[model samples]
Target: MTIVLTFMPFAVGIMDNDLRQLLAQVARGDRTAFAKLYDVVSGRLFGIIGRILPRAELAEDALQETFMRIWQRASSYDETIASPMAWMATIARNQAIDLKRRSAERLAALASELDETLADESPDPESLAGQAGDLRRLGECMQGLPNERQQLVLLAYRQGFTREELAERFKRPVTTIKTLLRRSLIALKECLDGAR
Candidate 1:
């Protein structure tokens, strides 16, 4: 059996206005609305995830896991808290952060592995496509950021460095690093239209 996917342009904007309406339907167990919602938001969600997690491969993994969580948690979205996109973005961001922490732990154990062991070299097409999508999105967001802020955010999140570590590298205080991260997030959220 073969699986096929299609790309559509700027369709998310058309559906975003109706997202709450569709999600309300989804909460009521409407399968059709769920399908429509998936079609509309998947790419936009990928874009958001790509910006938060710099590594294309890791971002792809996080994106899938994020959507899976969304599938299970759609009913939990409350309009009073925030918009649907912001709610969904929060879910994805949490998932990406969790994955980052886990990856750090996993990498810590790699010292025990012998260099003589062969590495897996098989190229996965799906992974490649997912990564390409992430890269495209990341490139756009990176371009949108001021050069300095971009570097700060990349150093902190993409490199998985602590604020203290970033501070040491930049010769700034840890409080400065934290402030930068907070400000960077606010700016990006504004650029991405208040996505959390």
Candidate 2:
């Protein structure tokens, strides 16, 4: 009789452990461990970027850039303030912002490509409103909140505007936008939960 026993090291803090250790191993030139870590975290990492960027093409680009940074900066992550994934989150966020900026620049350059006859007119509001049912649903929920909170949510999600971007757009301090978005998201979550 032949018997086989399977051992899962991660279950007891081996393979399934937090990212800091995997990153440390990566820093030491361990490619195998890095591959494993990538397989484990890529889904959640993609989800975070997808929520912020929305476009599949942009999200995919950010995802690739994010993993590349993880391999390069694995040694620089500070474990005191946050975990390795938090560091990865920051990198992913920056990549998404870069992608958005590039896309905006490209769109600006292509503005003249539209024919003047078509460009002079605006789309019908009813058609737009009908197509924006999803946005309207979310907007309805947001409109129920205070004015400040509603604006913060809109600036963050609608325009893919980061706190720093919102600060610059609003001609306010970065700290103000940060505080507003943080508080607004928390309040919105609570309101959503109460409805549930």
Best of the candidates, TM-score = 2
Clashing pairs in 2: 10-15, 10-16
Model 2 lDDT per residue over 1-196, tens place: 9899987553433433457778899888799988988898899789988987887878999999999988998888777876676778889888888888887776545433322312444568777766465445555668778887687778676666676778887887665565566566666656656654
Give me candidate 2's TM-score against the actual structure.
0.49
Minimum summed lDDT over a 10-residue window in model 1 is located at 110-119
Query: Can you write out model 1's per-residue Cα lDDT over 47-140, one digit (the tens) per residue?
Result: 8778877778889999889877877788898878988888888888888889888876655444223112223565688688767755666666
Give every collision pair in model 1: none
lDDT of 1 at 176: 59
For all the candidates, what are their Cα RMSDs to the real structure? 21.4, 17.2
Clashing residue pairs in all predictions, respectively, total: 0, 2
List the global CA lDDT of all models.
Answer: 0.73, 0.73
